[model samples]
Target: MSMADLVRAGAPELPEGYFYRVRSTNIRSLKVEIREQRRFRSRLVADTWVFERPDESAEESIVKACDRAFKGWQEADAVRASYLAVTAYLGDHDPKGGR
Candidate 1:
């Protein structure tokens, strides 16, 4: 699937300023990046996943990558948890303009 389609499907729940995109792609894997912008600072992170085409579809690949990325963040303990929390907060809040 195209990156735009993936973003539309996967990021409806994401905060307004926070977004995700296909950072890189090759024959074997796609790298997805998620970013958040705050009033004073911004953060970005990426997740890369290699999927066998015969065994997985684009949607499945994206889901797997996102799941693994989020899990990794949760497992990293303090620092990542703080980042995740901030991102989650951004996601929960509405944009400067109304939704």
Candidate 2:
């Protein structure tokens, strides 16, 4: 096989995914940021994001990030389902987006 053909044969399909970053604040709080994978030319990049919120606890932070990331990671059916469950559990609860 030619070099280009060999490269193509060896290349694996890339699945879209979410990328995250965590930063500690003071001693009791932290922030979480999430970005989804995107294709740039032939490469996948998850450097840009749709959700960036301040998180105080790691577990809670993950939930909040997933909440915001539902839209960015459109392929995540599980996240959408989880969001519905959360909403159902917290009926009448409203969330305010912070500035």
Backbone clashes under 3 angstroms, per model: 1, 0
Best by TM-score: 1
Kindly report which residue pairs in candidate 1 clash with one another: 15-91
Mind giving the per-residue lDDT tens digits that candidate 2 earns over 5-88? 322443222234544544465655554444445575232222222233564543444444444443444446667788888887
lDDT by residue (tens digit), candidate 1, 67-97: 5665554466567777888886564555676
Off by over 4 Å in 2: 1-17, 26-28, 36-61, 69-99
Over the full model, what C-alpha lDDT does candidate 1 score relative to the true structure? 0.59
TM-score of each: 0.48, 0.25
Supply the TM-score for candidate 2. Answer: 0.25
| True-vs-predicted CA distance for residue 69, candidate 1, Å | 1.0
Residue 5 shift from truth in candidate 2, angstroms: 37
Q: lDDT of model 2 at residue 45?
A: 26
Model number with the top lDDT = 1
